[model samples]
Target: MGTATHDGAESTAGDEELVVSANARFFRALGDPTRIAIIQLLLARPHTVSELINELDVPQSRVSNHLACLRWCRFVETERKGRQVLYSISDPRIRDLLHLATRMAGDNLEHLAASQRTGPDWL
Candidate 1:
């Protein structure tokens, strides 16, 4: 067993801090609606920046910015094909994770929706 620190982390210096920072960066990277849309689009297939702009209907610069963020998070990868740079999902596991999250959200939303629809029997 390792020594415990006062902060409930291992005595190993910087390990916990690094983990916290990485987790924050990951969540922050995916926090934006635009970034999530970019991920969903890339999950379907690789697309050039022009293609993405057309499909997403967002401004070119905004899409590019979100693509950069996704790339930094390692969720997106790019290739220089001809004159256009194509972006695709870097990890297939991300698609699986997204699917699982969608199911989980739907499960939760079903309860919320039923509650909202019926409301309180007393009311």
Candidate 2:
């Protein structure tokens, strides 16, 4: 028997459920400021955890946790070079998505801040 997907499309229920679950996990991975900073740093080039800790000026444990989350989401991947493991954005599309999102938010940043300060009524 056929089954319904998340969007009510006809498909294998198991496949669609997995896709939706993965997408949620992916968003959760990007949901944090720390992870976003990590992504920003990785945008230029891959970096070791130590380098990330230095550049972001965050605790090593915090950086490690965020890296783990990003890795689980497949937003970033790692490669071992010698003794150090370097982390980098997993997909080309991730960079593009971040760039576009930053550009859009940059234009509205002041307004967004103002809105937050005022209340949800403005929203």
lDDT scores for all predictions? 0.81, 0.85
What are the clashing pairs of model 2?
Answer: none
Q: In candidate 2, which residue ranges exceed 4 Å CA deviation? A: 1-9, 12-18, 111-123
TM-score of every model versus the real structure: 0.75, 0.74
Q: Which ten residues in a row have the lowest lDDT in candidate 2?
A: 114-123
RMSD of each: 7.5, 4.7
lDDT (Cα, tens digit) per residue for candidate 1, span 58-78 = 999999889888888899999
lDDT tens digits, residues 1-123, model 2? Answer: 668657787877777788799887677677677999999899889999999999999999999999998898788999999999999998879888877877989978778645654443543
lDDT of 1 at 84: 82
> Pick by lDDT: which candidate is best?
2
